[model samples]
Target: MTWGKVREIRDGRCGKGRAGDGKESGGGRRGRGVETGQSLTLQSLTQWKVPDLGSGEGSQEGERVKSGGICAERAIAKHRAQRTPISSKNSSDCPRTPRHSLNMGIFRFRLMLLCLIGSLSHLNSSVADEAEDISHKDADEAEDISHKDVHCGVPVNISHGHYEYLSHHDDDTYLSVIKYACDGPVYHLEDPEEAVYICTEHNKWKNAKLKYKLPECHKVSCGVPKDIEHGHFEYVTTHGVTSYLSAIKYTCDANYHERDFSDEGVYVCTIEGKWRNTDLDFEIPTCEPVLCGRPVVHLETHQRVVGGQMVVNGASPWSMLLRGADGEIIDGALIAHQWMLTSAHALQGEGRSEAEIKANFHAYVGIEDAREMDSAHEVHIDKIFTHPKTKDAMVYSNDLALVKLKENITYSNHIMPICLPAHDLAAPGKVGHLAGWGMGVELKPATHLLYVELGMANASQCLHQLAQKQPGLFTEDAPDLFCTQRSALEENVCRGDRGAPFVVEEGGVEYAAGILSYDEACRAYTYAVYTNIYNHLDWLKEIMANH
Candidate 1:
């Protein structure tokens, strides 16, 4: 009465009936060719058959028979439901026998159930196998792509059969590649070739007979190299003064201090070729609240000059006064010995001759009189010393020169030495102001003394690029003179501002630090080369002693 026993009886009855029919008709097989399962071999098949139910006796065991029939039908229905057609074929061709037909209703139900379960298992295995194959092929492709012999573009996997090329005319290079997936549930790239063929077994092969015909590619024109414009600063090892051109140093504007780099903060041109301050502790920098020191001399006017740090006496005509050989008026640096610090270039080669310089030269320390100097300190042609390394006439070096005054200045509120910057004044982040009788923002001739404030730049950065242009300029032999260009193009010191004094507001006092040097013609910025007094304190004292 078991399900297995019922199937055996059904199969037996069908086999016997088929054999009898075959003998009567010529002993031929009637059922379609059925491949036996390994589990249900030929020997096992003989045992499987439907039992004959003799009319009355079989009816007496109706309940047991019914249960057996139900179980067989469920199994058959499961099978039928799960079985998938391998190919396009007629389902009626493979018919069930009469005994099988007797249980066909039940058997069909079991057949469907079996087929559903089998199909699910088949689908899962198929997906798993396909995934594995793809992973394996991808790994292989990665290996092939990594080979050094492979130039940028052409097809590489000629062996495994997948092939294609991509061309982008708008792009700078022909290195673009087109990727494609193979057919079927197992989509893996088997090969890269002219013609690729995939099989049912998930094996792909490239046909050797097919030759690739590439599409007509348009020529690509690269406008600029990506790195030059967007690349970071690259340090080209230079000898001597090459470091100055790089402009790698940053000094905070006056009132601003470097907190990020601590004491070691130095401005550098980044690899991207853009200049940035490395000394700022925060991402964005801000100018510190700088308290300008009380000038030894009080000014009548509270109006601020170009440099943000110092104040000029409003009562004096010298505030916006013009003097010197060129008849151009520039803001004067109030040095200690009653000498006004002006741009050496303002004197130019003309100052080299006393006759040309003395006749037209005039010095006024905020004097009321406009025509003549209040105290005409004999414009003595003492030693005119420029930076020993200064070479080019057009581009003067450390463009600074000192004119010794005939008399010591009185320490009065109205006339006093502008404070000298404390040693270590030019450390990065120290804002300094430059004043000179220079032309306005435009390159016109100097009308009056103009003053402008610019932050100190790192010596290394200015020299880095300049060093390349002129070698041996940024060496220890040359003093530690750093250069700073105008932060805003409109605020730069223009022509006739050479030899201007750079002063720092320290301890509420303006102190002279360096001299305006030269202008970079191509750029809106001008270069002010400052002599490091701290570095040459001993020399300065020695020179003063001789005077």
Candidate 2:
């Protein structure tokens, strides 16, 4: 009755004959329907007795099969249960089939039922094994998917910027949001709208506004500052660093601001990456000189004059006196102990030969009064060197000359040399002074040294003005020549003003900024042109080096 260790005594298949031959075998023999231990069930269903019929003996019922070939066993060993029951009389009922026949039919039904139960048990075991394997496979696939869609961690850091997480489930998990900001006022985000990013479900950090792309942190750059006309700018934030939200200061050169324009202190690099003045809309400030009328100026009481004003003695120690034998006086600048700067045309006095002019010309320094030549130090000329490109024309472009003195002059309050244009910044529209003994009233030479103040005007405007008087004199683009502001006075520059030293004072020091190259007719609305000393520095340095 141990079902687990039961043996199959019938054929492996249900409702059939013996496992080998189709014959009915007798009791006491096992069937071959199944493997060894599976061959017997209920002890082969044979040793018990059935009701005897014709012979009053036990029939060979265990192996009996009907013509239809279905097994009908009627007897088996009931010894274990130790009980056997024969059908009793059914007197009133129709006569029953023989008791043995009835027992065989009941046995057959029980045998078939047991075979079916065994078949179902095997099917259930196979189904359970398959179900367990499918469950394990599903778990493995779920694990791989969990690894692939992992939550995002902290994103990469950006230069000049930082990020911080907003409300989220975790620091850098999915659906987390982060805000971006620049490191300082000197830097800005490239895109403000994209400053917030999200940790996406796809395990990536993405911009809040964009679907797939990651957010970017970019440092702003305000490229190179715009070029200022007649002026310059410098960075106050950092050297050679124009990027970020930096700052700058713009300033005009010397003489550039006579009256109109003024300085704007702080120019800043904006979030949009542009250089701009927070107060003004202009990107660059300009140094523009007024051409027609005199630019209004604030002059010191002692220095209020511009048209041949007489000053105290030794006021212009660097002013040189150049006189012709026929009493012609020309103004010059004393540059060194032995060197003097003048107009190249000064060497060509009207009536004197070149050799005679060199020998007879008298040069003096420390002369405030033209009439007091005896008190001035007279230096004889050792050599007369005019610029090689000097033109003896009405409008001289290279109207520069140097006179080498025979003796080395000593420096004193009344006889000092002026500085060369080296490191001297001559700003347009800034006033500069000129010292000379100009031709006085009615073509008479002045009895005292005179000086005048004039602004250094723009070269382009000066050329235009000068071209109206002498169209062929200048090409209007003279690089070495520069002009002064027009005088509103009746006589500002006259005949005796030629080669006068134009001194520009900066930081308490005086520099020889120009030499008078043109003389206007001593009338109102007249402007004079000069040779720019800065442009002639190379030639002067070359000459000084050679000497």
Candidate 3:
């Protein structure tokens, strides 16, 4: 018979029941105490007759509750197959009941059996449908999760540490499946309806999944110079572009280093979940020349002897010269023609024109008296060149300059050349002198031409004392300039003594050296910013050739 015909027969007994809607009347709840023996027998017959239906019966059975009921019937078929057959001879003691009574009883039993089978079939169909729905829902959720970690790629055979979970054993049983995988044991759980989640992978899930909601990173900055010593960083982009891994680490080149306190080359994560490297190398600038010391002079006449041996004078003949704008006959070695190499602040003055200086000229070298100054070389200055990046207006570490002289003097004891300091000689704490034609009393302006000297002070003492005196002058710039003061208060460079000479005595050879420059408010204290003549020799030479 067809599945439809069989269903019709069952419905005739149960009075027509639907599977999904649970709309079967009188088949549920009211007949729980009724005998289940007849109902089990009916299920067995249904299962036995299922295979006898048309081939299409399988599809029809799946569409309704018949398929699950068939399973139950099959389960009963085995039980029935084990029953023993009775012999006709032994049936003589059978009661002689009326045919109508017997038929009614059998019909009533069949009705009850059909109702019970229908109910069980309906329940099995409901469970199967629910399971199918759950499977589809799980698949959709897994798809969404996979899309989020598209960049992380497929998580293969990935195993995590210990985790916690909840499980519903049954109406009376509870379980706690802490770690479902791995060797972790399961425990007894209480709540059945609540969902169980493992918190062990929270951090991993946050970094890999939930963190995607963070802001998009445009640029990643490395190194917190203010807070860290050194740091290394590594990162990979999870957005639009595929397969992006940041290989560039933040690190300083050799001979150069970062001042950050973070460990060298460590990767740090930012608020955007991106990473940066903060490793840098400390740089060591190339060493240059040392331009310091005073120009040596003839002890008998105190006249400047230009080309001679002093300190920092390498084999080179070019030496730095510094002269006072005032009548002070302060001297220094001549390093260049276009640029007068002297103290850094020596040029701190109202640069005078050649005519203005000539008009107000009072004294000249080689002449004993102003009246007989005709033979003395009158060097006219045109422009003063001071370093642009000096420390401050008054103090400078790179105390040097380039003075444009209108008339170049031929080499002589009074106009001779000096040596330029090399790297070895130029260093901190070196001594130097300052000479100028400034007034003895700083209160008055510079007057008649005269020479004075002061010994070189140690670089450390000069820097320390100067910084104490002028709190703002101690910096990277001050260490480069040398310092000195007048040997005697009676003779010192005053206001107009700027651009004078600073010299020292050694081996009886007079060397043209530093320039006389800045002094404290009173003549009681003075400061001479030294010159870097050797380093600027080439720069001076190039400018002079073109000029």
Best by lDDT: 2
Error of 2 at 208 (Å): 99
For residues 361-431, write the lDDT of model 2, one tens digit per residue.
78888777766687347878887777878655344688887888888876543556777766645567877
What's the TM-score of every candidate structure? Answer: 0.37, 0.43, 0.34
Task: TM-score for candidate 3, please give it.
Answer: 0.34
Question: How accurate locally is residue 454 in candidate 3, as Cα lDDT from 0 to 100?
Answer: 50
Task: Return the number of clashes found in candidate 1.
Answer: 93
Question: Model 3, range 277-362, lDDT digits (tens) per residue?
Answer: 44322321121122222222232333243211122212222333233345433333354433455444434434544355435443
Q: Pick the candidate with the highest TM-score.
A: 2
lDDT of candidate 3 at residue 484, scale 0 to 100? 60
lDDT score, candidate 1, position 275? 36
State the lDDT at 242 in candidate 3: 15
Tens digits of per-residue lDDT for model 1 on 1-547? Answer: 4656434543443224332132322242322222332232334434444333323333434334444554554455655787843321332223333455556654564565455446545755798999999999999888655542433433344222344443452221223334333332222232345233221111222233342332121122211211211112223333221222233223344323322232223233333333344444223332232222334233322224333223333211113122666565533454545344444544555434545555566555544334335445223333433434445434444444445554444332233455445576776667766545455444565433345667777777766656566675444345556766665534665555555566676655666676555543214434445555555445445555665
Over 4 Å off, model 1: 1-311, 314-332, 338-356, 367-399, 445-448, 467-479, 519-523
Report lDDT (Cα) of residue 463, candidate 3. Answer: 65
Please estimate how well model 2 matches the true structure, expressed as its whole-model Cα lDDT.
0.64
